[model samples]
Target chain A: MATDRIRDFIRTTRPDGPCLVVDLDVVRDNYRAFERALPDSRIFYAVKANPAPEVLKLLADMGSNFDTASVREIELAMEAGADATRISYGNTIKKERDIARAHALGVSLFAVDSHEEVEKIARAAPGARVFCRVLTSGEGAEWPLSRKFGCVPQMAVDVLVYAHQLGLTSYGVSFHVGSQMTNLDAWDAAIADSKYVFDKLARQGIVLEMVNMGGGFPTRYLKDVPSAEAYGQAIKGALIDHFGNQLPETIIEPGRGMVGNAGAIKAEVVLVSRKSDLGENRWVYLDIGKFGGLAETMDEAIRYPITTDRDADEMEPCIIAGPTCDSADVLYENTPYPLPISLTIGDEVLIGGTGAYTTTYASVAFNGFEPLRSYVI
Target chain B: MATDRIRDFIRTTRPDGPCLVVDLDVVRDNYRAFERALPDSRIFYAVKANPAPEVLKLLADMGSNFDTASVREIELAMEAGADATRISYGNTIKKERDIARAHALGVSLFAVDSHEEVEKIARAAPGARVFCRVLTSGEGAEWPLSRKFGCVPQMAVDVLVYAHQLGLTSYGVSFHVGSQMTNLDAWDAAIADSKYVFDKLARQGIVLEMVNMGGGFPTRYLKDVPSAEAYGQAIKGALIDHFGNQLPETIIEPGRGMVGNAGAIKAEVVLVSRKSDLGENRWVYLDIGKFGGLAETMDEAIRYPITTDRDADEMEPCIIAGPTCDSADVLYENTPYPLPISLTIGDEVLIGGTGAYTTTYASVAFNGFEPLRSYVI
Candidate 1:
């Protein structure tokens, strides 16, 4: 949903070209809700989701820690008034030089999923604290974090042992149920796997200190999702069942959930027409597309709710495409999107739940179109 | 293949981070080849493939016309020393305002596939020369452009008729065989479709003057494609068979064929590891991934030949991925790529056949990594 502030900003300013408008108030509320839901777990805002300076500054003011994937993100966090202790290098795949750069910038927490990554961190960051990420099934996640990321639980044990031997603190275990995960019980199996790793490490006299639960919290899109309180209760029940009252320090990295529903994209219909007189569906072209900012719509996975001024008119199915010449820029074709029959060229539409991944996924200048502009109010 | 100049530049400068190096000499040579192969057809270099200033300047200096997708691309071509007469607003889907802007910039040639688009040009550019694009089967292209662009052949005739009625010059018909088209006969059916439109419009007293044979020229990747001379001969044969001695003025757009082999990307191996002891293949993480510049690997469609220092060593299948935290960044996983067994972290590898569609497709900063840097020498 577009917050009142965002809607008013667009109605008044009327910025040229397609752009995303984010309401900081909505983000602030989302942050507070997460804090209330998971009071025991520290919130580390994932910088990759939406690293706009205003978003970073607001979250930093709220005392949120930062989960960064690169040295540039760590610098962005630090620049937003966060200290080095409040930043964690959370990407499991990193060059040794990047690891050293993060260490030099005072980042002490690092993530590792492989022996190679562990070796790099050990050589570059020395005695940094490392958390081993165990693989998850990602069954219920719309955007599954596939096997390309974490390792098997058994391999995580070996990775942690190697880190302990290399003088790096084997901090704990972590797992992601995947982005836009909907199943409340998705965290139960992962928490059990973390407990297994913890028990195996403890038997070797190497005690882990924390359990870093990677981000999976979902934001409302075309469908309603489980509330943050429901996710917190489900996760808490899993933690209690696995750890038996000896709970480890917990941390949650929320990327999309914190910012996804806080912004909206304003785009105009570029052209609308049928291929032939008997063509089945009309093709509606917009200024923005896969290369512009709506990349999460790849494969039509994340279908954002679209609202046009002519919503009261009779609706008709239409294929939505971007303004670029590339055929792959079609946003919705497998399942045609229904739009008002009265919709015409130059009509304005608002796409909701686009705050998180939209801006950063935009191409630099594909077809001479500029990257998605962001206006934080 | 990376030309000697590009390889030498990379070896000597050793630029930091993953970067693309384009050899202007190779681009010049490619332009010469296209001219020699299709002596009767004018060449319009598609700017969307590689809009680098040096590339545009080289083509412009060689008397090549430009097919631009947006107003900025038109400005870029003009800045590169091309006159407005040599530039065509080639994208069929455009905002009316963009059409007006391009017209204001003195661009008189436009492309339209639908009556709605034709109307936009008619209102914005008044009497601009317009071409109707007919749909093709896209049978033999590796990257098959689906029905997102172009219209049925019959509809193209209607569109051209409408453009002429609205005071726009119904100049001709156009169709793309699809990008990276490998089949030498792929243009035959499209050329036939254009001839049908010509005959249909001629009966209506709106004689089409040109057949804008759009870009589909292939670039060599892992497999060798038909040469420019072979494609030229096949296309010329199709034109002669269709029109006999009454062939219209012809224009061919070549984007990838002009620059795909002229550039190479220098990337570093970030990490290499297996998930478990029983895992079948190793995972090789590179500093660059789909979001970095290799977006054409969306479904592992374009497999560029990679060369490493240890290429002579024993080879094994590996799942290659980027350094981002996103799981979708994996380049080749369904069919793992075979790499040298001795390849290790920090090793330098060169990805060839990346001159086209690489830099422009890069995300601004997906995971805090900057957009793909380009160095044209």
Candidate 2:
């Protein structure tokens, strides 16, 4: 939903072209909610989610740590008032020079899922704290991250062992249940895997000190989603069920959940028509589409709730697409989107739950259209 | 293959990050080949494929008309020395204001697929030359365009009639066989459909003049594609078969065909490792991925041939991915790519057939990485 402030801003300013307006108050509230829900766990706001300087500064001022994927993100976080100690170089796949750059910037924590990555970290950032990411089934994720990222628990054990031998601190283990995960129980198995690594590493006299529970928290889109409290309580119960009394230092990286709902995209309907006279569905073209920022629409994985000024009118299913020359720019075609039948050209539409993973996914200038403009309030 | 010029540029400059190098000589040769292929047809270089200023300038200097998607593209073409009369606003979807802007900028040709779009063009750019896009099955395409673009032939006739009623010039019919199309006979049915539209319009005394055959030309990847001359011969035969002796003016919008083989991307291997001790495939992470550019890798639809310095070494299949934290960054996994067994971190890999659709698809700043840098030699 577009916050009252965001709605007023759009109504008054009427920024030209497709633009995203993020309400900082909502981001502040989300940060507070996450902090309260996981009081025992440190919050590492995933910097890649928004990376807006204002959002970062707000979170940093509120004492939030950051999980960055690259040296540039580290610089952004630092620029927003975060210390190196509060930042983690969280991508498992990294170049050796980047690792060295992060190390020089005083970022001591790093993520590694393979021996090769560990070798690079060992050489570039000797003695840095390293975490091995264990693989998850990603069964209940709306956006299931397949086998591209983490390794199996057995391999993670080997990787951590290798890190320990290289004089690096085998400080922890990490696993992402997957992005936009819905099932609350998704963390149970992953927590169990973390425990297994912890026990195995302890036996080898290389005790793991933390479990970085990577982000997968869901944000409300077209469907209702559980609150941060629900996720935190579920994750805490799982950690207790698996590790008993002594819980390792926990870190939760919340990207989508932190900012997805804080932003709303204001776009205009460019065209509305059926493919043929007898066509069943109306094809609605918006100024923004896949290349414009809503790339999560790929495979129709993330269904954004679209609201138009004519929503009070009778509704019909429509094939939604972007205003680009590419055929792949269609957003909701397989499962047509339910939009107001009265919607026509020049009508304004608000796409909700686009605060995260939007501006960055936008192309630089595909079809000569500029990148999705963003305004942080 | 990376052209001699591109290879020499990369070898001499040794750009620090992943970058695309395009050879103007290759582009010039491609333009000549297309002209030779269909002597009767006019070449409309699809600017969306590669809007590099140097590229546009080169095509403009060679008397190539431009197929533009937005007003910015029109301005780009004009800046490259293409007169407004030589550019076509080729995207069927458009904003009314944008149509007005294009008209004010002296653009007179427009594309429309539905009555609603025709109405906008008529109201915004009165008496503009409009072409109705007829639907194609998009079969025999490596990257199928699906039903997001055109209208059915019967509906196209209605659309053109409606355009004529609205005081717009119903100039012709257009269709895209699909991107990276390989089937030589793919243009036959589409051309036949155009003839049907032309005949229907002529019966009503609204004489259509041209047939805009939208781009779908293939580029050589791992497998060899038919030559431009071969495609030209096939298309010409299809046109003659459908139109008989009195053929209308024809426009060929060749995006990928004109530029895909003219450029190459130079990237470094960031990491190479197997997931587990018993893992069968090595995961090769490069400095660039889908978001950085090469978004055509979505669904592994377009596979660019990858070459390494150690190609003479033993070869094995590997799962290729980008260096981003996102799992969707994996380029090739379902069908593993065969690469040199000796390939490891720090090794340079050149991705060929990437001249088109690379720099433009790159994210503005996903994961804090810069967009794919382009160097036009």
Candidate 3:
């Protein structure tokens, strides 16, 4: 957690090119720590966060289940020796082949958001287990998948009853409040909704045994954000409180929380320029531009970039843009640069907070630079 | 451009899976169209748009130059049979290896943005053909390379003088206003800036033979965007006005404008649901979400979907979202879904306007999806 430790890691490594260095020790420890925190509930490692087979293998080795949203991801988890029974295909938008593949792989658990998906699964994989997805409300919830995927609570009850009539066993209820969720009350409300569905299904003589609280526990993107442990405990406590003792063998899928801070992108500075017209500035262009690993922040607000140049003290403000011709390419806005830091032409800079949705989520095509060569600690 | 024609392509081919379908015929037509429109100017096919060797070969066969920004891309163009002398390394960020490789490959034309870059290139590729990039104020000028790479006009004069002193030939002046340019006046303004730089270099006793008017001609995103022919002619006429009979040999690099509409993503409609709260709304989720090919639309608003459902006339408004669990995964918002369209559960939807940046430039990580399968049409 100390800057000195990161500095030491960078100094000893001295990478020859643009790359990503991952502390496998930190990652494995983080995985094990999350699992230890929720010993009672099964952990479905969300593969969408970081789908590297090695990482999946690490989680599988740690006795963690996986939540796959696609057929190929399911295949990857299974190839990594994940328990087929423990694998849950949680995607609401299901292709026919996807369902058949999951069924062929003996994956019993499936997430169903629409009645159309339920019918498709029934026709394709008649014996697979299914769960009801309920829609809950929240602000900044732009384009809610609930509106696009899940049915109303009453509609979900009808789907469950219809499943029972069609000889399909409905064993669980699942709801995703949203990603980067800051409201614990949203999770609490979703848990309450799941209980209502559970009771309604029970009235129809159907007993549910699983309640999947889909993961969205935020990683502290900035200071003052709640820690993952605090987020996890709050949700877990709500699940227990809502369902009392019959919480249906709870399962939590924490994607970003487990891997968001365990890695960093290491890039070398390519150029440094000074501009007087743009409010007096110094600019450092790195070889690791929007093409390499910073593509996500290409046009958003100011991105946070830190210099790895050693023995620096005085600071100045400068803009960091990528090498691509696209005007949209920028790494950060008028960002601070340590002025006294003797930034030679070819110094190094480490782009931090890139562990979760970076290499595993984005592509590098601008300069034909693939994701950085990842090194496990 | 008929709906039936697109459907024929998808149904007849039944390719392996979701992949890039590059219509070589369409690309060749685009290439020849641009060449014929600006018969006098040089056309440098920006390989960053579609680095597939065949595409490069098609352009190279037609007597076009290659615009590369990295050592890897330059080498790829060469491997694809591009003449070393005809390739211009227009990258602003110069790595040590990049300069060395350009020198080794005998690619003389280069874009120099900084005095340090000039020094590095002079040391590495001593006799390389260099162009001093200048900043131009225009309507769409943003994320200016001048901020990261270009020298000021005065500094450019100094750099040109210094390069002459170092026995390095300053071949020309180059400037990129921006990408996806809608304002054609930006091209005129850039040419004016190029003339100023050329004149200043001439005063410094650095005679130039070429004026590289950097790329960013508009491609048709919406119907109202200017046609390539109109924009190309406007630029050509402006170059003639600025340089008159002594007009230097010209070079133009077009990435998206060349391949933007040459291909599309054909995805199947997987799940359909209705939003009761949002009124009588129906949502059709595609098998190919953001990962499949909708990655380019993640930033700007772009929707070029063509429904193959036979009942196209019965169109209605529907929101389409990708299959990813991320809440921000809406592919198209409030788009009209034609009725009588065959977009039932398993029908296919061809997403157009994806030929340029969507294939290689977008995110391809989650779902373990393969890159767009490319086929020469």
**Model 1 Cα displacement at A256 (Å)?**
0.5
Question: Can you tell me which runs of candidate 1 are displaced by over 4 Å?
Answer: none
**Per-model lDDT:** 0.94, 0.94, 0.70
Instruction: Write one digit per residue (lDDT tens) for candidate 1, span B318-369.
Output: 9999989999999999999999999999999999999999999999999999
Better of 1 and 3 by lDDT: 1
In the order shown, the candidates' DockQ scores are 0.92, 0.89, 0.48
Better of 1 and 2 by DockQ: 1
Q: Write the per-residue lDDT of candidate 1 for residues A1-377, one digit (tens) a residue.
A: 78788889999999999999999998999999999999999999999999999999999999999999999999999999999999999999988988999999999999999988899988999999999999999999999888987889998999999999999999999999999999999999999999999999999999998999989999999999999999999999999999987999999999999999999999999999888889589999999999999999999989999999899999999999999989999999999999999999999999999999999999999999999999999
State candidate 2's TM-score.
0.99
lDDT per residue (tens digit) for residues A282-323 in model 2: 999999999999999999999998998888899999999999
Compose the digit string of candidate 3's lDDT tens values, residues B1-377. 32344446767988645555667677787888788777777888888777877888888888888888788888888888887988989886777777888889888888876677788888888877788777765355221233454656666666666676776888888776666666777878768767877788777667887777777764554455677788777888888788777878888888777877777667667777764444666777766656545655553245464546565356666777776766556766655544343358776666665677666665556566565566545
Clashes of 2: 0
Give the C-alpha miss distance for residue B189 in model 1, angstroms. Answer: 0.7
Report the C-alpha lDDT of model 2 over B1-377, residue by residue, as the tens digit.
99778888998998999999999999999999999988999999999999999999999999999999999999999999999999999999999999999999999999998889998898999999999998899889999997988899999999999999999999999999999999988999999999999998889999999999989988888888999899989988988899999898999999999999999999999989887888589999999999998999999998899999899999999999998889889999999999999998899999999999999999999999999999999
Which residue pairs overlap in candidate 1's backbone? none
The true-versus-predicted C-alpha distance at residue A63 of model 3, in Å, is 1.1
Docking class of 3: acceptable
lDDT of 3 at A151: 70
